[model samples]
Target: MSDADAAVGAEVDVDLDFGDDGLVPAVAQDAETGEVLMLAYATREALSRSLETGRAHYYSRSRDELWEKGATSGHTQELREVRVDCDGDALLYLVDQSGGACHTGYRSCFYRRADGSVVGDQVFDPDDVY
Candidate 1:
């Protein structure tokens, strides 16, 4: 790590601003390509685990539990860097993606443009994996 990065990391003492529901939005991005892969919610425990293990972890509201990215599809995201927004209410996870990030087999969750134009090439076949 660069001296600057090391210094920033050493200051991992910010109070995470969780919402009233005890959740925060965590956005995951591709470290190299700078593509935003996905956005998921994280609880305090999930955030701690991600910081601890250097992997992308999230709390699924649907499942009501912690889940590591790619645990089932083998498309794990290794943590590269983590950043909190100025307000400390949001998180950014820069990760090295092993496979596609989206369950729909796209490289990013932002597959469709707001204008309804489908974007991004499919990186994998979801059927083959999940």
Candidate 2:
């Protein structure tokens, strides 16, 4: 399925190049504002679930399982589009996000600067959750 098809929760029929580990890098972006929200890995199942549910799903390498983006924190990423790079090795997920994407309570995972300064104010407090 194309990104437009995925946005409407249709089955994706595009080619994908999964790595040897059976995973592919997936980048999540803000659908309306064009902000990069986070980077994660997704298995085929994850991709299928995202398309089936209209929500983002990713394979957690650290946890060794599929996870829905906002299952715990309520910071769900509503899938809007899914794009495959020309090489088919990477994916871009455009989403309508709710709440902060970062576990640290930031709107994005890339909230820190290389110089050790924060880019902007944090949107939420991690202490309230896990």
Clashes of each: 0, 2
Estimate the lDDT of model 1: 0.85
lDDT of each: 0.85, 0.89
Of the candidates shown, which would achieve the greatest TM-score relative to the real structure?
2
lDDT by residue for model 2 over 37-103, one digit each (tens)? 8999999999989988889999999999999998999999989889999988899999988998889
User: Per-residue error at 25 for model 2, in Å?
Assistant: 0.6
**Superposed Cα deviation of residue 53, candidate 1 (Å):** 1.0
* Candidate 1, 1-130: lDDT as tens digits: 5322322222367877897998999999988889999999988888777777777899999999899999999999888778899998998988888889999999899999999898887999999998
